[model samples]
Target: MLPQHADPIVAIATAPGRGAVGIVRVSGKGLAPFVRALIGREPRPREATYGPWRAADGQAIDHGLSLWFPAPHSYTGEDVLELQGHGGPVVLQLLLARCLEVAQTALPGLRLARAGEFTERAFLNDKLDLAQAEAVADLIDASTEAAARSAARSLAGAFSQRVHALRDALIHLRMLVEATLDFPEEEIDFLQKADAEGQLQRLRSALAQLQAEARQGALLRDGLQVVIAGQPNAGKSSLLNALAGAELAIVTPIAGTTRDVVQQTIQIEGVPLHVTDTAGLRDSPEVDEVERIGIERAWQRIHGADAVLFLHDLTRWREPRYRVGDANILRGLPEGVPVLHVWNKVDQAGDELPRGDSDIVLSAKHGTGLDALRQRLLQLAGWQSGSEGLFMARERHLRALARVGEHLEQAQGLLTRAADQLDLLAEELRLAQHALGEITGEFTADDLLGVIFSRFCIGK
Candidate 1:
């Protein structure tokens, strides 16, 4: 009942299609007038009333339940109304159109809601912070039950609360440092103070621990990308088929049956693994241009992966000299990217499989040595598949934590320097605090919110 000029925004809150019910949501000021024009009665706040929804000309549309959540307490922190009707596509469309016509007459400033606009408004009104707001979408889009529960925890501010705790601790430390700086007489003592150094070390330790958790969470959310690469018929595809426990990839005795990179996504020990088996790398003069293209693309995938499993067929590669440029592949891979040397088809050559240099001899056909390979993969990923204490996170969160870590490292270096630049230390602490804030969206850009929420489904 606030005013007449604020146009109500309307959209179908429920997903499109036939279902048990569909929800049409409208939010804005002057919601009462819009409801009055549509249903001929103003609904009590937070009440559900069975009503016959109608058009501007007083024609019945559909019989449904109307819910009114008025003003600052609503999801978007506005006067909001929802109409739940039977969900036939045509019926839902007609109901939506009828409501829109009523809104157009009853309110002003109304327009089609943009992607994530409702959530954006909720954020602006302080109903939720950026991290919690993002969790709303994450929960809805969660692919697994565990993922949904983790996201729900984040939406409830579990992640943000921890971040805030760290922020508060950092602020206190910065205050103490700056206070000592104000008294130049004590600055020398403070610079050499054991307590001060101890506090800094403790803070760094806490940040490091948080970074580890954030990393685990990110892996839970994004999973790990593992690509298998080597010469043709080195059991790359066979290995994939074995791990997947199904015929996800076609394996034949003939080499090059897999012309393109074959991919399969499987959850092992709760860690999502995106496994790719690429076409073999060979220098065959008989091969055509298309095969060459696949080989080039194979290398690209290998370079982009989180980890590469370089397989060497022991029957063919008898000695270390015959090992497929094992040194060259290691050199080409980016530093810090883990490589697993797998000697496949070991069943064919028992004691002949190379023993030195961290090699695991396995037969993809018999599923021998698979458990060892799995353990190795989990180790490289920094945790076992389906490991406990995992949560859902993202690259944005990790990058923010990493920035904080870098700042802390830089501050430690400055503290050890000859100069007692307390001011510089304070600046680094501030930067670290800001970086941590970005993880929970206490400090962020509008574009970032757009990007994060845009990834959500339309109804969300």
Candidate 2:
């Protein structure tokens, strides 16, 4: 029998606040007694029964539908109970209180679940692997339709299957190498005859492809952070509004109109880009205390940004002062962050649409060249559009895959260096398999699991 937690857990599974209906879930081993005490009888497994949810004193709490899923066939591989009732917060609380009250005697030690405990139990019970369990949270937290679809695919085992396939191949290759090491006396070149080198080559190729897909998925999970910075009246706020397609920021011709950072998350071809518009960068004794604070905040955002869109006024580019100001701002930019030099307000510059290899020219006010800018932002994000096989992935997953790749590279190097170094090659292959196993929780640390599951909302 599978190991199971003895204590029962209860929680309001639905989102907080009033809605048409709400669900209260209970999970544990042998919850039939608790169900009987609350509803006054046993519920047929897998069947929803309409009844009055009663208190210990037989007082009716609320009439609703109740579902019972027996152990080994339910989520968490435990006896599960679900109460669907009116979504009034008060009503749900009363029902939840009743369940806890009944559990005090009928199912002692029943308590509220910790964040992600439900899914964590599912993982422990073999209902889902580590990646699939994570996908549950990703699906719930998906910010876009594309993200949601990809998360669904992950929850359905798309990503896990790929990892498993790679792991199986690694295991096969490791077995062959280990066997060769065991038979050092039979120096008949069994590896070459078994095509071990060919197998290693194919595994490397597969890992590279999987790594690319995982990178794209990680980008989807953690969207790009783009900060827009420029001098006052450089159309920074205007570009923010243009990108967001909403008047989210107060756009004014007056310099330093945006004295605080304004943020908007806009989607380009289904990839989310978090854009921040910051206060103008100009030093003057007339700059007020609040504007100075905003300028400081702008620099902070730029330093943390994945990409920076440094807006330059095309109309003022010819001015000596403007050129000097641009150079100073450029000097202050953080090293290693990709920055796009954007020239805005071509209309005011009285110039035809200009294009260059290193800069993008656009009139943010008229929406000219906006599409090109959007496409450029996507490109900088390393996004691959229209990849139907993409699935949601976390940074941890990427790190695991990267480690696997490194181990594989080391193994390949050892194999190519000398055929007699089979022992070293076997060890590297074993390390690679172990690294790949971490992705699916075949091998993982308890502390890492704690960190991963702690971020989930309570009740999963």
RMSD of each: 3.8, 1.7
Best by TM-score: 2
lDDT of 2 by residue, 1-460 (tens): 2233456889988888999999999999879888898898998999999989886677788999999999899888889999999999999999999889888889988999877878888887899999999999998988888888889999999999999999988888887887777787886877787788889999999999999999888887778999999999999999999998899999887888999999999888778899999999998887999999999999999999999999998877778988888889999999999999899997788745444687888889999989989989999999977878788999989988899889888887887764667888888888888888888898988778778788888767
Lowest lDDT sum, 10 consecutive residues, model 1, at 1-10
Global Cα lDDT for candidate 1: 0.78
Model 2 worst lDDT run, 10 consecutive residues: 1-10
Which regions of candidate 1 deviate over 4 angstroms?
1-8, 57-59, 181-195, 319-336, 384-390, 413-420
Model 2: how far residue 309 lies from native, Å? 0.6
TM-score of each: 0.87, 0.97
Residue-wise C-alpha lDDT for candidate 1, range 253-315, written one tens digit per residue = 886777888898776566678899998877678567878888888889988999999888888
Off by over 4 Å in 2: 1-5, 352-355
Top candidate, metric lDDT: 2
